[model samples]
Target: MYILHRTNARPPLDIKDAEKSDTVHFINSRSKRQRINEKFDAAKSRIERHQKRWTEIGKELPPQINRRHISVISIGGVIGTGLYIGTATALIHAGPVGTLIGYMITGTIVWSVVISIGEIVAFLPNVGGPVGLAGLYVDPALGFALGWNAWYNWTIILPTELSAAAILFNGFFPNKHEDFIRQSNIVAITTMIFFAIVINCFGSRAYGEAEFFFSCFKILTIIALIIAGIAIDLGGGKEGFIGIKNWKTPGPFVEFRASGALGNFLGVWSSMNQAVFAFFGTEVPGVAAGEVQNPARNIPRAINRVWIRITLFYVLAVFVAGLLVPSNNPDLRGSASAGSPAS
Candidate 1:
């Protein structure tokens, strides 16, 4: 029993020795850690104070979209009346070859723009997208300017889209009186606005779902149109194996005002506006990075798909349209009442 007691006994410690013990050291370290944490929190708060109010509020809403949603948004956000109707104007101005060349040039530009936007969005994932990117990395004043500029653009675009839809809706009744067309346009605009409000009110998830559905539909429709145009060219219609007849007859390029290569070059240049218009919304995927899951992975994937969308949707469609119609067609001139040049 005496041996056991001796073995269990601990050595005595002096004041200095006790201060260096594990328990005391742990206590001191814990207090130091607390101070460090407090300083860190203070610095974080100070930094956050400089952030935009929207950036703070944006974080409160968790990401609600996935890779597929982002891809669809990027792919379809800009596929609209511009491609369907505006291409006609391009064809009228620049003939088949000129229009095709203009679109190809614009496609390259669009690809570069989307790539740049995707890189920035993946790195930063800002709420204001390009606007926020400018503020954080470039200059806050630049961001502010871009924000208001974007606001002005969207404000103009919203009403213009509604007006375009109204005009297209009026196209169904070509023989209708002017008053009837005007009234129909009013009704179409109101109905579209109501649907837009309802869809947006359902939140991002609903918007994503709706966009996906429409994107798929548009994809199928464009594909069908292209196939039909090809078939008609290859003797699938009464025209019977049109081949490159239109191209040969009208020649490859049209002059804008002059009668030679200069006119053709000018025609191609003028068509650039419509080509650029066709790609207006291609950057939406970057804009949507804040609302998408795993933006680092998904945004780049979506950006990679931009070229595919441009080639299949815009380039091929333009090529097929050029094949199907002569640039000098009177219908391609388009009257005030003509809603669609293709139609």
Candidate 2:
């Protein structure tokens, strides 16, 4: 509990008697500042009380977790359900060039944020992360505001992620009974959530081991996709050589908003939100800086590598997708199936 001091009540100073009452004027001015400070402290303490429960969750999280775990999480967490299929939407609205332009711009922005936060987290690698930093270095109001925003945002994201995983899985068996899929979805989400909680309960070392293997799997999967995409583009499959043919037929750029070159640029800009979604989790390292082994070494390293990895895995993958699939494809418009773009 924070103790707030209240100053004694005083009357307002009159300018007419200013020369005669310097002490009274000074006392009134100082008391006014103290009252303002007391009010601010009260608000700050109230916010911190609400935030205390969230910080307690980190108390059980051990600090032995190393660079490998944090690094992979930083890279892997960003690759979400959006990357798996929603990118198809971007391709449709914006053609290949537009999509590329949007991703590059968004990627640069993400990179800037990652680096800026990395520098701060490296300097003060505390457990509370952005939540703590906002109050400590910046204003408490900013911290309180951002903390609630993040809490609200992430709370919504969790269930959506579960449903998304189920949806992507259901895409595999298009002929399966909907009732069975619905039942299985309930089972899958429950099981996954349970396992995630169990892993987290085991503390950071357990998490490090688990995430290490998962990251390896994710990296390998992306590599495989890129390779397969290239193969498909170069006439690897029985479909014959694609070789930028789709790009030429539909034309590289699509006019989206108004007209001329400006519309085309806007078309590219339109996918910025989707690109932002795709590049969301690149800052896991900064968030988990307190638990990581070496803040200075690991955080900066992750920041540097994350951008390149994202470009290679995401940007290049989108490029390959554009080359292999046409922007005007009906699947992008949801005419093909309701489940997933891949399906």
Candidate 3:
């Protein structure tokens, strides 16, 4: 142990005094170094304590996902069946322009949230996922609330995705009886749930690989759609030269459950629910920060690509869907067999 002493002295005026001043300077720098070392040790201890707690509980998440896996997952998370099927309902409730506006607003919100989260994750990737982070940085109560809120959200979303898959499956057997359709839906949902459980049980590496494949597939699908949309807009479809005709004819907005400007406002407001659902998992990369290889480097890189994904996959997709399909098309409200504005 060492005692730090403070000295008050006049400026050095001669060689002998200069030597004393040098000694004092050295002492000050050594003290500063000791303070930094103490802070480093404290921070290291905190991280070790967290790791020990998780290890004791048998829940320590090992780093298994690489940069590519994490990046693709974040990009594809936002491009789900909700974006595929739910947007049709948005179009019906609010016209093309209104749906576009709703999606843009939601995208902006997602971007802001991910940017803030990215900075924190780059600094400290695993204070535990978002739940642990909230407890550490904010309040324990807020962390508890977020934990339960996430649980509730996932619970609902799981069933919703399963149901949406079943609906899409039913599209193949259009002429089948209602009873047969119901049975097929049950089978599809059960099969998917079973596969999901099996995949997760295989451990984090397997899960990351699986996500990487699916995310890549989704990315390709969106890219294809973007190209097709451009072609269709440029008079490649049967409806030649179909520029912004939908916008002009439908008048770019809808009146929902009422008449006049208030109704149109309501329409846009209601459409936000669909947009929110579409963008629900945009922060998935942040959630997986703990398991990402070299998270301090990878997490920020993955998050930086979020805006690109949003602009290309989501915003552009909505723009194309609006241009191609009219909001008034009764097919928008028809059975799930009709299959999305884009479809």
What is the alpha-carbon RMSD of candidate 1 to the true structure?
14.9
lDDT tens digits, residue span 1-343, model 1: 1121222134538777545542411123346687878766764553365445546766888678888888877776677767877787898889888999999999998898889988878766644587777765556688899999988977887887787777677666777787887889889999989988999898788888888988988888888998999999999999789888888878778899887889999999978888987788788888888788888888899888888789999999999898889988887765224564453
Q: Poorest 10 consecutive residues of model 2 by lDDT?
A: 20-29
For candidate 3, which ten residues in a row score worst on lDDT? Answer: 22-31
Question: Which tens-of-lDDT digit does each residue in 15-78 have in candidate 3?
Answer: 8877767443224435678887876676577667876775564455567889878888878855
Off by over 4 Å in 2: 1-62, 257-262, 335-343
Ranking by lDDT: 3, 1, 2
Residue 97 Cα positional deviation in candidate 1, in Å, after optimal superposition: 0.9
lDDT for 267 (candidate 3): 86
Instruction: Please list the C-alpha lDDT of all candidates, in the order they appear.
Output: 0.79, 0.74, 0.81
Q: State the local distance difference test value for candidate 2.
A: 0.74
TM-score per prediction, in order, is: 0.81, 0.77, 0.81
Candidates 1 and 3, the one with greater lDDT: 3
How much is the lDDT of residue 320 in candidate 2? 83
Superposed by TM-score, candidate 3 places the C-alpha of residue 47 at a distance from the truth, in angstroms, of 6.9
